[model samples]
Target chain A: MLARRVIPCLDVDKGRVVKGTKFVNLTDEGDPAELAERYAREGADEIVFLDITAAHEGRATMLDVVRRTASRAFVPLTVGGGVRSVQEMHDVLRAGADKVSFNTAAVAAPELLTACAERFGSQAVVCAIDARRLPRTDGAGQTWEVVTHGGRRATDLDAVSWALRVVELGAGELLVTSIDRDGTRSGFDTELLASIASRVRVPVIASGGASSPEDFVTAVRDGKADAVLAASIFHRRMHSIASVKAAMAAAGLPVRPVGEAVA
Target chain B: MTGSKPRIAILDYGAANLVSITHGLAAVGADVVVAAEPSALAGADALVVPGVGAAASAMTHLRERGLVEPLRNWVRAGKPCLGICLGFELLFDASDEGDAETLGFLAGRTVALRDAPTLPHIGWNVVRAVRPHPLFDGIPDGSYFYFVHSFAPVPADEGVVVARTDHGRPFVSAVARGSLYGLQFHPEKSSDAGLRLLSNFLRLVAANAETNARAGAALGSEVA
Candidate 1:
């Protein structure tokens, strides 16, 4: 059986990890490679670096960050955000990223998923969907809608349907973030996650609104997520990865043991 | 640190990402080289064939670079060689993927993973040793390793299989015969156990070189 993955997302801007980390233990929090190395020691199953950089010049610096982090860390590293073209995706992979996740670009041009999956196997291509629950105008029922541009813009596409379509288009995995629960610390939108996870056969990673280790367990046991990703909780040092894995193990879910001789 | 080190060649066919393997081998103190052409692989103590893209396209790239025959000859001569992921699948007789024929180094057929709940079995899973092999010398019996694939090879002779892992069904995760090895999982990304496994391969390479040199020296003494 595959162990459930616990990932810590690092938001990168201008080649440095953004200043959201509030933990005192993280020395040199500006360097992504250093922080990633620390996370690996803390037993992070994977690392997700979201390139929050805007300008082209900054993007090049972000690639350097990826190269450095990949050299130091051995676990799977996923670089996402602002990856708009196939060439950019190639650059990230060439820089040693194991997987690349696309959000706005995938929404704007669905064909990009096919093109990427063709060039760099589906295993390396990920479709990150940010969705929110919205009430129906027809007075019928509420539906989860796909939102993009950092959750500022909404699309007519339903989340569940879009997920099934991306899988058909050869998306090996899906990273679905609940915009409603994001930064709320209210727990994951299990209804939305279960809806999507059941409809698609690919592994789904549930992101956003995990404030505690129990929430991580709920994300897997109830939300049916194959993996769980959090940012502030881990960044703020509210819970260590070992504590979360212990919680998951206590909940009967299998997680890889940390500090058992892997560096 | 030493003048005489294990000279390792990492075969690059524009298929998979070779950086991780190169870095992993380097971390273990092995002198690594990324090469494509046959001449570039010459004078190397061992070779590593790493694959990431489609199997058919990987075979196309290998044939285009004229590396097929040379690779077969190298492994046939009992030289140390390691095949990873798609490269592992490429060692079989044929694959259902693109109906492509492979190196035929191992008698097997590559088929889509049956009953797999997921298409690409991504993430870490435990690998159980089926038989004692040097590739897993220091590694524990059920050490965790990362795997991402949609298909797995079913070897004709199961005895060559050194380890087994199950996603939806029991399948050959690692196979070894003589000096040729095929691992379905990515050891470079598997963290500590992976580094240890790569180091073991390097040790095996050095040991093999020593044994061959001693045999040649004994032959020379007999002739004298």
Candidate 2:
């Protein structure tokens, strides 16, 4: 049986790892590669490096960050943000990233997904969709709208429908983040995650509002997410990965045992 | 000869990731070399074909460099050779995804799994050994191996399959016949189980090389 993945996401800006509340007012944490190596040592299944910088300075710094992190990190690394072209995707992959994720760039040009899939194989391209629940119009039904440009602009695209389309466009995995619950420290929006996971054939990774180990359990067990991505809880050392896995094991979720620690 | 390290050759057709594969083999204590030329492969005790990217593109690189015939000759010689993922699929008759021509060393067709549960079967999957083979010596029957692929081989001769795994349903996950082996999983990324598998392959390579050398010596004595 395949084990549920536990991923720690690091927000990188100008090549340094940073953390902020609701994607605002960021603060530096440490060297991206050092932090990534620590997470890898602590039994993280994968690490996601999101370049939160604006598009003007280019994705060069992020590419260098990925190369540095990939040298120290043995587990799979996912690089996202400002990934606009096939050349950028190829550069990140060549720099040792196992997967390159696209958010704004993918939505801007949908055919980029197909072209990337054709070139790098679908498994290497991850389509990240950030969504937030909107006010009900029919007086009872709420809608999930796709948010782009780092959750600044709301598109007419429905999250669930767009998820299916992206899969058809050859996205091997979907990283769905709930903007409303992001950085809230409450829990994952299981309902929203389940809605998208139910519709898509590919693996869905649930991100945002994972404050505790129970949240991760809920995301995998109830939400049926293939993986759970968290930030604050891990970044601040609120809970170690070992403790989380121990909790997941106690809850009866299959997780790989942490082998003997290597120096 | 008994304690000598096994000399394994990783066939480099100008497109494969030779560095990573060499590092992985070296980590497991095997004496490895990136054999880019046909003659270098002959001197190797065992062969490994590691690759990334599309099947058709890799095949083109191999043929353009005039390596296809020598590789076929090496496999026919019955020396231990293992192919990873794309390398493994290329050993089959052909791939339907890109209509790519393969080495046809193994009797199989690599086809894409359509309308199944998932596209690329990424992450970990158990490689349940369905038949006994030397490559699976110490590896447990249900040991899990990491996989990342969209297409898999459907062997023309089913007898060559040594293991099967389930995604949508049970499919051939590994194949072995005599000294030839093909694994549809990335052993370098599989942690401990993967390292053990590589160790076993090294042992098999050394034993096969010894056997071949002895046979050659016996023939020489008979001729004299």
| TM-score of predicted structure 1 | 0.96
True contacts kept of each: 0.59, 0.24
Best by TM-score: 1
lDDT (Cα, tens digit) per residue for candidate 1, span A109-161: 99999999998899999999999998777866557999998788999999999
lDDT of 2 by residue, A1-263 (tens): 66677889999888888888756788888999899878877878778998888765757788777777765555677888888888878778767677889898888999999998878788888999999998878766556899997678988999988999998997999999999888788899888899988887788999988888999999988888888898889989999888888888899986755553211
For candidate 1, lDDT tens digit of each residue in B1-224? 13558989999898646778888899888988888799988889899999887888888899999999899899988999999999899989999987889889999899989998877899989999999998887777888898988889999998889999988898899999888899999988888898889988999899888888899899999999
Interface RMSD of each: 2.0, 4.1
* TM-score of candidate 2 versus the correct structure, residues matched by position: 0.86
Backbone atom clashes (below 3 Å) for every candidate? 0, 0
lDDT (CA) per prediction: 0.88, 0.81
Per-residue lDDT, model 2, residue B140, is: 68
How well does candidate 1 score on lDDT at residue A24? 23
lDDT of 2 by residue, B40-106 (tens): 8756788998766678888988998788998888888897889988899999999986899799999
Q: CAPRI band of model 1?
A: medium
Off by over 4 Å in 2: A13-16, A22-38, A53-73, A250-252, A260-263, B1-22, B30-45, B132-141, B213-224
